[model samples]
Target: MRKNSFAIGCACFLVFALLRYPQAMLEAGAKSVTLWFQQVLPSLFPFMVACGLLLRMGAAEIVGEWLKPLMRPIFGLPGIAAFPFFLGIFSGYPMGAKITASLYEERKITLSQAEHILSFCNNPGPLFLVGTVGAAFFHAPFWGYIFLFCCFLGAIATGMLFRLFYFSKSVNDFIPYQKTPSPSITECLPQTIADSIDTITQIGGYIILFGVAVEAMKQTGIFHFLGNILSFLPFSEEFLCAMSGGILEMTNGTFLLSTAPDNLSFRLTAACMLVAFGGLSILCQTLGVLRNVPIKKSRYIAAKICNSLCSGMIFFAMAPFVEKYAQKTVPTIAFLAETAFTIPIFYIKSSIFFFACAFLFALYQRR
Candidate 1:
């Protein structure tokens, strides 16, 4: 009864705001639509379609078989987890959670593993991090590479940390994995495209609504109030405002940070945190996709918060190097690959070693 009343009240407030500030709402909606049509649709649609096709083609089982050894020991997850991990990394935002829910619904992964994977797999795609953020926002593709590496580093850390403390009774329960049918490409292409369209449309709706919500918050002074609350943090006014915006939505927050008259290091740190956290808008999108699956919202929220902090720390540590490398003018695929590999190798290997040691310790204790 209380929940229903709260939702009703919120809806009424939104309607009132829309009527009160029609211009702001309209502009916000237009910008969001443009962003979705130009950037989000092009980058995400093909990946979504590809992911749907891969799963439909039984790619999970195949990938799982190959990845089982690495996944089990390091992450304490099933081999099937690779499906979401790689796809989520490549596709970015909610895809990881989306795939996990699908796997759970299909009985490919148990509930606990689904929850565990949620901690780290979902992230912003390379295109966004490198092209949109690095080149477009910061005017330095090198920082984009730094952000990508740090963001992924944080994710990897979150996974290992979660595995260390995770306890579940069904961790050892073996369930027969569902084998997805490998239909002909021509046969499955239409359904896959249809499903991808539905998914992207839902994402588009959320983006536009959140865009309006941000404008509404601004018109009502709520956005300023939120920013004012964080003034004690030693950051500039612009930084505080950007952070507040980021708490509501990721892209908006990062754009604010990029435009703020602050040092590059501070902006980089804050952007990493916001991107990793993925904002309330992203949380809603994840919830929408997983609506049919029974997963704990609280746990997902906690994981995102942890991930943000982890990524922020990484960005801080690497800020010096980023500043040193900020002058790389000719940013290309080779440079990105080279930078990603060289910079994160030490951290990645250390994390893997630490997790492997912990896994062995767990085995010893069990014995």
Candidate 2:
């Protein structure tokens, strides 16, 4: 009861402060809202919907069966682990945590397995990395792919570590395992789309809220103060600033890193490390999804650190090669002409075309 009261008191104080600075609050809130509607939502929504439909439609069993041979040997996990592993790589961020929780809640995975999965699965989505961060911010689409590749490598390294310690399962151990039956596409379409939208909206809310909080910190110069403290160490000012922002929120931190006055390798390394760490916001989302399941917080944090370190090392190793080629991959004018003029129309048309194709295929399959 005392703790609850103290928490409430703290919350009230924060609210009061924000109200007192209505201008700052409004500006911060607007920026957060714009990032959601304009950037995050468009990039992640399609993948979220696709992942939801895939998972519910029994794509897990299919994937699990196919990947079982390699997954068991390499990851020390049952083939069922493939679902969240792959989705986390592609769908990004909290999706891995969310899927892991679903697997646990439905008794598809054990507590230990779920814990190991969290160590590696929660990652930045490829679309955001490649499209938004790479193309829009860095002006190098290759950087996005580089980040994605390093993330996958880092995740695999983390998995190998876990396989040696926590997971003792071998290829022969899971032969008896079975998967859930998926519904026909027509049968699951409505729920798939609905659940995807709901999850995306919740994710959007968290992103926006965290964005505002980061903005508030910036407005108050807290990040600079934090950077000053870090300057005592060997880290650079740019990295310190990036870390200060990334520590709270993933997207905000990555965005900040892009603008940091550092070499491409330094900035890219920092961004990849932060993505692997996944910031506190990502962890909160992960734990919230896993609230019902038994999880060891200390172990989880340690795993994330290990994963981050692994990602950082891999990023540095290939970064020189990446930088050498990324800048010259395409001419500026041609790239601009395509991105500015040709892509939007093609993207919209392709999206519509695919949806129509899926609709027709579903109808035929249903009959």
Q: Tell me the lDDT of model 1 at 86.
A: 76
Q: In candidate 2, what are the lDDT values of residues 1-367, reduced to their tens digit? A: 8869976974675576477677887787787777778766786677776776777777777777656555666677777787898788888877888788777776767777888777888877777667666666667666777777788889889888866557554333444556556688888778767866776677677766676667667776788999998898666777788888898886677777877777767888988898888897777766765678788998888888898999999999987754665744433422112342122333346547854764565445446
On the 0 to 100 scale, the lDDT of residue 117 in model 1 is 88
Flag regions of model 2 displaced more than 4 Å.
1-13, 168-175, 179-182, 185-187, 328-367
Model 2's lDDT to the true fold?
A: 0.73
Candidate 1: misplaced stretches above 4 Å? 4-6, 165-171, 174-181, 328-367
Q: lDDT of each model, Cα atoms only? A: 0.79, 0.73
How many clashes show up per model?
0, 0
Once model 2 is optimally superposed onto the true structure by TM-score, how far is the C-alpha of residue 73 displaced, in angstroms?
A: 0.8
> What's the TM for model 2?
0.80
